[model samples]
Target: MTSDKTELNDAELSRYSRQILLSDVDYDGQLTLTQSHAVIFGLGGLGSPAALYLASAGVGKLTLVDFDQVDDSNLQRQVIHREANIGQDKVASAKTNLQALNHHIEISTVATKLTEAELADLVAMADVVLDCTDNFESRFALNRQCRRHGVPLVSGAAIRWEGQLTTYDFRQAETPCYQCLYKEEQGQELTCSQNGVLAPVVGMVGSMQAIEAIKVLLTLPTLMGKLMIMDAHTMQFRTLNLPKDPDCKTCRD
Candidate 1:
């Protein structure tokens, strides 16, 4: 399963039997998933569920990136980190949990912040990049790198019962990127630590990210030019079209 060949073993077939049952993710789609590589940035609320679902769904390789350590506070929303792993680096804890969930997949961890060049290199090698990072700076950096590398990015953010999910398929000439929707000049960024977020809110967004990542790998329809916003407080969901900004600094060429 690690080589260029894409074949599912009997065990793999059985393990992903439920997913393979779907016409959307049939045998071919499952094999595509097994041959795909997904890079996840941030191991907190969003990254936690995204990584878990991706691993359980049998994405062949996962690169988990996070520079922070797990805090006791993170356990409230970051389900991948156990109480015992509170002091451990987030990438290390996430890898431990992900491997325990599915040992057949390859899980790599980067426990430090990456420079621009380094991030670009990683993005270039990924089939899809999951932007679960908490801040605007990281999100902006990831968006630029993904756009430069022409990799699909599944971006999710949740703070204070509100969450948003979107995908940018940089391979598409007209796809809207993160920078198209947000400007770095908008300096006041809200965080769960500063505000507050329901555990399930981020979980939902992260799970959707996993779904989008798998869809991107399988060449299925995705939310490439749409943003899905969820108001957990009101239990409402709205989707809006995201047009590419010709003036966007990152994607405007």
Candidate 2:
């Protein structure tokens, strides 16, 4: 199921014709996408759309990680899972749908929370990692791993009517890790179950995460050191610079 093709076959060209039409994602870019691997850590609101787009866009392989099972309450925003999958593991549900979307791509699922060592192994294998996970603990753990492996990380979050998106291209010396933006002590994690969220807000942020991931694989310009904030209520979007923390424990030399 692994893709190591340097040239796109006729079927692939037709399947991704629209994307290949873009000057930036021409034949070469499309081929690059088909040869890339992405690891996603979550299958809820944010991970759902992010996984969908990456699969449809022809990322060669995707590793979905989520220990939670599909719940009735998740239907409102976790679009990749269906009502029939209510009791299924989130990663399993996501794998089924993503494969249905693109059988040409390889999809793997991890139905358990990964230990730091396990997480590091996966991050080291990925061309890009999407931090669709919730909670500061998971975010900080992933940030440290991505920094250690020098893999780009696309992090997104949505709670209530606000959403945030950022990329940490760890391959670059000056890029900031997640800890640089929000200290561990500053994390007062909020959840949709507790605070409630507008469904489309997560969809928007997750979709943007997909875009940034593709850009990373293509070596195109991305929000590497910038954070994008969205207020769905006001329908306004803002991008701010995210500078590196010289004292960042995970990324500081």
lDDT against the true structure, per candidate, is 0.92, 0.92
Candidate 1 residues lying further than 4 Å off, grouped into runs, are 1-3
lDDT (tens digit, per residue) of candidate 1 on 148-251: 88999999999988999999998899899998999989779987888999999999999999999999999888999999999999999999999998898887
TM-score per model over all chains: 0.97, 0.97
In model 1, which residue pairs have backbone atoms overlapping below 3 Å? none
- Looking at candidate 1, what is the lDDT of residue 176? 94
Please give the lDDT score at residue 190 for candidate 1: 88
Determine which window of 10 residues in candidate 2 has minimal summed lDDT: 1-10
Query: Per-residue error at 93 for model 1, in Å?
Result: 0.9
Model 2 stretches with alpha carbons more than 4 Å out: 1-3
